[model samples]
Target chain A: MSEELNVSCARPIGSEVDQGIDDSFVIEGAEASKAKKEETTMIMVGRKAPDFSAPGYHDGKFVNVKLSDFQGKWVVLCFYPGDFTFV
Target chain B: MSVDSMFVHKMWDEEELSKMVDGGIPFPMLSDAGGRVGTLYGVYDNEAGVETRGRFIIDPDGVIQGYEVLTPPVGRNVAESLRQLQAFQLIRAKKGAEATPSGWKPGKATLRPGPDLVGKVWEVWKVDQAFED
Candidate 1:
């Protein structure tokens, strides 16, 4: 890793949201306020998944698991340091 | 781990994982290739370059709907997370326009938008719109 990369903050990626306020009952202003707060630390939602493929050890074998294979099921892809031996 | 190798290798062996599964450990432990998945997910320690115990709940469509990242000494609650998953799945299944409230359980009340909705949220079936300010 570069030392220069370590000393700075990375800008958030994605589209900018408008926070302009026009009225009360219209409720667009309140929505902008909430969006602004969320924009600070919010992870991107409703986007295409990052493509990935891996060998998963299951049932005494290393089976190939890809993001595309799970087209119809909810896949909880979790990554940990090694294996959680203490937990 | 190198970026070219992320999610390519199983972090643990089958025997250890089998034991965890037999002990009622739910969810699959994806290998991050040395720790490549962790790095891309931002849960990886750049200095050490290993996963930092992060969990992500991806929807059926392959989108990461929700996630939680934790540092060492802090663990994730599987049961609670499962509940959240159930709520998410249920809400999605129903196609109701609402989000689950705190401690939301399946088959319970959900929230909707309206003036009198809050009063009867416990009786309705959506929780997203019933969130209290």
Candidate 2:
């Protein structure tokens, strides 16, 4: 990772990010922004949930899992690059 | 704490994960096919067509209470997420609409509602009664 590419996460993507071990790079910049510039006036504290219906391989047959399906449950929605790897 | 699992799809075998269970990794894994959920969550690694590691703990009310999107090649803490869910439930039950302070833990003091209480919650056990006015 070069020094110029090691900018902090104060700015959004396309600014700069750390390089992965494989020489690959991923952005860790700000994913959200606020309307005001001051810290006290800023209010970007909530998460935005996504909606989709997709066929999941459940019970040996494909079933759909929609965002609304888990409406009443606390959803721990995670995303991983690939399974089986350490990450 | 009630928590559901959802993950982006990648080729993995259940048997391998089962063998590593006792090694400290906890929680069930779900698969998100075709990077759809990854794109939606803004954690998709576009060049690789897979999601970078990211975690979110949504409350039963469907509000996200704990979230972390790690840079690629970095794993997440499943146990930490579970702990967060428990704390979030306890706080939500006691505080309702008021927000939780950073690093909030169970049995700790919380900020009360109303303008008079602003900045009055100095610590977990030192809430000034005057702010209740």
Candidate 3:
């Protein structure tokens, strides 16, 4: 699969995502502006959770976690405010 | 998870979170640096350079089943999240044959959905049935 993300802003769908072999999205050139972003809606129920890969801390270890890593399991992503600080 | 760096997450886990929950956060504390992921989810506050509190329940299909995003001062309801998760699972298992009512809990009565049951839901599903289990 090509590493480049399509320009249209629509998410890719189907079996490519299920197997976790698909390339991650890389938005090149045009940056999505803040003004444009305000028009973007929150991800709704039944829509695909945008796939992401990032570093995470767990059990005294740091590992890179991808949303696809937990496919086929119910995942609850609880995003809280900064650690050690009250929100 | 927020815009904190990986090392900050380590410190928070070792210094603070461990004191609250046994052995620190039970699940991975992801570092969404710059609130990139948060931005995609519409929880990022660019002006503050931080991501607000948010919770998303994604089913096995990678589809979002439920989500809640909030600003500060309002605490998240863990019980409500669990209820939603259970309800989503039940509905998925039933393949749309049945539906859980308000405040539904596991083992509680499930309503069979159909045209005939549209207005008759009250007859088969009682308010008391939701609290039975």
What TM-score, over all chains together, does every model reach?
A: 0.62, 0.58, 0.78
Q: How many backbone clashes does candidate 1 have?
A: 6
Order of quality (TM-score): 3, 1, 2
Please tell me how candidate 3 rates in CAPRI terms.
acceptable
Q: List ranges where model 1 is wrong by over 4 Å.
A: A1-43, B1-20, B23-29, B114-133
The better-scoring model by DockQ among 1 and 3 is 3
> How much does each candidate deviate at the interface, measured as C-alpha RMSD after superposition?
7.5, 9.3, 5.2
Docking quality of model 2: it rates as: incorrect
lDDT of 2 at B96: 71
Better of 2 and 3 by lDDT: 3
- Number of the top-ranking candidate, with DockQ as the measure: 3
**Best lDDT among the predictions, by candidate number:** 3
User: For model 2, what is the alpha-carbon lDDT of residue B88?
Assistant: 77
Give model 2's DockQ, 2 decimals. Answer: 0.19
lDDT sort, best first? 3, 1, 2
Residue B20 CA displacement from its true place in model 2, Å: 2.4
Candidate 1, B28-127: lDDT as tens digits: 3344555444544567677765667677777888777778777756777888678767977986886767666675676665565667776775676445
Ranking by DockQ: 3, 1, 2
Q: What does candidate 2 score on TM?
A: 0.58
